[model samples]
Target chain A: MTSPLVTVTDLKVHFPIKKGILAKTVGHVYAVDGISFDIMPGETIGIVGESGCGKTTAGMAMVQLTPVTSGAVLWKGRDMAEMTRSELRALRREMQLIFQDPYSSLNPRMTVRQILSDPMDVHGLFTGHQRKERIDFLLDTVGLSPGQADLYPHEFSGGQRQRIGIARALALDPCLIIGDEPVSALDVSIQAQIINLLKRLKRDFNLSLIIISHDLAVVEYICDRIIVMYLGKIVEAADYASLYKNPRHPYTRTLMSAIPVPDPARRTRRIILKGDVPSPISPPDGCRFHTRCPDRMEICHKQEPAMRRFGNRHTAACHLYTDEQAEPVENKPKAKEKIS
Target chain B: MDQKTQASILSIQNLKTHFFSRKGVARAVDGVSFDLIPGQVLGIVGESGCGKSVTAQSVMGLVPNPPGKVVGGKIFFHHRDLLTLTVQELRKIRGAGIAMIFQEPMTSLNPVYTIGNQISEMFRLHKKLGKKQALAAAIDMLERVQIPSPHKRVHEYPHQLSGGMRQRAMIAMAMSCNPEILIADEPTTALDVTVQAQILDLMHRLKEEFSTAIQLITHDLGVIAEMADQVVVMYAGQVVEQARTVELFQHTLHPYTRGLLASIPVLGHRTLGKDEDLVEIKGMIPSLYDLPAGCRFSNRCPKVMDMCKNHLPDLIDMGGGHQVRCWLHTREMIS
Candidate 1:
């Protein structure tokens, strides 16, 4: 098999909670606790979670945007943490970030051409005559006309501005693009346009993509592999079909069912989790999701479950199944309970 | 002959709300009509600039004046016209007869006051409870909405609570007086899906317990399909289609609705083929100040005809309470 484009091992990001005038660090909020995953070349991997789950933080840490407290993020066999300032800047060109909120992400004062060229200028890639041509080409690739390059971000709609955002990410011809809730700020129809654009660009440029979103369906559409997060841990990781078709972890199963189906005919019984996600600063013991998990056993509250692998790459961290000893977990069925 | 439907709790007829700015008039809610049956959920779905929120504001008489005004039409709450009510009279019915829950709870709730202090005011105003009694009832209200440790949470301000908790507090205040109607505009849009599920479940339970009619407005069809008994599809400040929830999904008529349904990637459904592109509605929503003389959606409509370009199709009723405004559905279509 071809070597993975990026590999993140045992990553942990902790933010200290400060109190009082002295600004003493009282306790650390376990933002990303410990998570590990990898992105293959030309593959689209999605990190799915709710707010405070550290999905965004995990993505940022991989690209060296957020400070990684401890862990190794190896980019093409080189550890990113060991890189110098100039070397880190060079690494940024290979991995660019696309942000959410098209309204706030783009600078109001900058024109489309300026936004696209700023990255190129910083990187010192193209010069003079060729730089102007590259800007025009980037805008055209994103489906905007060359004439609209002079217009400021305020003149464009949400969808068009997102396209401009994508063009800026593509300015350096990066090998990877990490989008954190990229299309969540746009309308449904506009979201579709952007999703399709990203798919096309990925295929054309052979780029590895990491999309971090709270939206499961949007991620399900574009990503071939998915990692489900709860609090600050990866509860499950599987190929697209296996995760949705046969989810192993209870949290993953509940999350899959929680989303409201668009078609009225397919209204399934939604298993609403009991309480709010516990604060990351003081997350629950053992399994972070044990406090709210419906299928919590006695062991779940005392000891964290190991990631047990099923067929192929489908793995889930749950005590329900043991390695090869237990029968297929789907055989024993329980009566469906609907909460009114 | 302004006869009210006996079962309808809220009735809006030919409602027209406009914004008079320096540029020109923006017909935000032009010629919209809908009725909310008692205890039923009526969902209004559309993109931004489609005026779903403005329509809700018109019913509550909360539209800011000076620039925004109810230019025309009547808002009847059971037999009284809300548009004609004075500020004092409207305030009397505001939280008691009809209540509203905004999208952003943090912004809507006052920062300085404690949650208990804010909710107790509703009890004192509407139920005429004593100060101590009102505070007790506020805690009870918090319990009803399923907020954990209601007693301690009551003393906390808005910022102290989490996003999901703040939203529950908002819901509690709205339901404290047991209003006949609850208008929630994009209630769970800002929330995560898991929290969204929790809020939706709470709303369902409260609705069943109080039997309160809900006017739910959201852009997500998933939420609309799951909760709304009746669905009204809006485009460019006009209702393009209205039908019962199941009927609308099974037999989607309007091109805009079809485009919207097809565009969103649904969960638990078959994924699209690798080569296929998502069915996107072309072009942007028209600016309210300059809408088309014809069907407002005609400019981007995939099945537009010559007649659809010049003459607007009326919202024609096609029996069984299904109404559609498109040349394909209307007999008034001149081919």
Candidate 2:
């Protein structure tokens, strides 16, 4: 990786819980606890996890939208945490974030013209006439008509609003774009359109994209590599082909199996996980997934496993895969259980 | 599971549920028709504005009146025409004969009331059970739905419970009356994958244990494939394709169905390859307020013919009870 665009080193973000009356500091919600990854230039990396897994927190923390408790996020080999106000402001122009729900993320009062130009205005990039021209270019780039720029977000449909959101993200000519569940809120038919638009934009701009979504299929389709997070930690990180072919982590396996295959006849026996994700406030001791993992060993409840590397660029955090003294359970295909 | 052999538990005949808003008349469920078999899961699959949820609401008699109305057609439940029934008569059948479970567990459950009170209300109203008996029955129902520590959980409010547990409690309340049909409208859509799997498994087990006909409505094809015995593919509030689950997947007749299946990025080795764009349906779903004259999907249909643009096609019954509504298929039938 020739000087990665961004590198996150052992990042941890803990949100403090405040109680009644005195507003006393209670326990902390370990949102993005000790996670690390790198984004190479123009590469699309996907971060996937269910609700409360801290994928969103990690994405926001990377962009400096959320305050980080500890560790460093290096933007082009420079520590972003240490950057001064002026430096951080300059960096913001090259990095951007797109939210899941376009309806809520976008301001209803602002017209599409204002929404796209305001970001550039904040950065002091283009002014007045130049900004207007730039906004038109952006609208056209996102497949929306230049005339529609005068209308408010309410005037457009869910799909068009998302396009507007995308146009706003692209306004500053950002090198990196973080889409947190970007297409999840959109309808099935419209989702594909937005996804295709994202893919095309990424290619056209040579942009480094970080797509965070719970939908495995969506991630697999677009992302060159995927990072699977479980309880504020990355359980597995692998390239698309390797991850889909041989997923090592029990949680990842369960998640992959849980996805409803469109074709009924090709349905695989689902490894139905037993329970919900343990509360993030006080996550399970040792391995966070031990309580739900079917193939759990004694060590999983006592010690957290390190993320070990496998076939080229593939890594998984599971005792089963780690080179440890404990007898490893032979990974075998489970008996086919009928869904009906 | 032959359609003719299995007795139709609930039959919908050309049901037209239209919403009369100030803007225009949105034909949410325009001439949609399907039959649910006893103890069988019938999946209604469509994207958001395609009227899958409205169809479920129409069946439950829960569609809001002033703006909404079942303008035309018949809904036969146990050979009784539900459309003709009065509000009071429909109320009797709601919890006891047919139950409904919504997508958002939080909204469906009352935040102020305890789980026990909510569940017991069903038994009290439908089964005529007293407070003591109703509470006991509610706890039993909670246990049946596999909500851990039913005794403690029953006393807890909805806010105290997690997303999965809240849905489980909702299911418990739905099953408290032991209704003949359960209309689960995107029941697990709001939960996590693991939680979704658990809820789906619970629904499957309950169907087997109680022999309750389930009308599962969702946009997820994967959910439809796993749970449905039969599927009705709707487009613009109309049944585009209806067939047995296996047959539907194997021989997908409708172009719209094919497009939907292709649009989704499948896991493992599948159709889409590297560097290939997903086959998207060209345009947006036709506006229900003013649908195209011919086929609802004709505007975006790849194999659209001249007749498709001019005249609407009827649902033509192919062999083995597989029906497809398209000019191409109907033309083939005519030939």
- In the order shown, the chain A TM-scores of the predictions are 0.95, 0.94
Give DockQ per model, in order: 0.74, 0.64
The residue ranges of model 2 lying beyond 4 angstroms of the native Cα positions read A324-340, B1-6, B269-275
Error of 2 at B108 (Å): 0.6
Q: Write the per-residue lDDT of candidate 1 for residues B101-207, one digit (tens) a residue.
A: 99999999999999999999999998999999999999999999999899999999999998889999999999999999999999999898888999999999999
TM-scores, all models, native as reference: 0.96, 0.95
Alpha carbon deviation, residue A237, candidate 2 (Å): 0.9
In candidate 1, stretches whose alpha carbon ends up further than 4 angstroms from where it belongs are A324-340, B1-4, B270-276, B331-335
* TM-score computed on alpha carbons, candidate 2: 0.95
Least accurate 10 contiguous residues by lDDT in model 2 chain A: A331-340
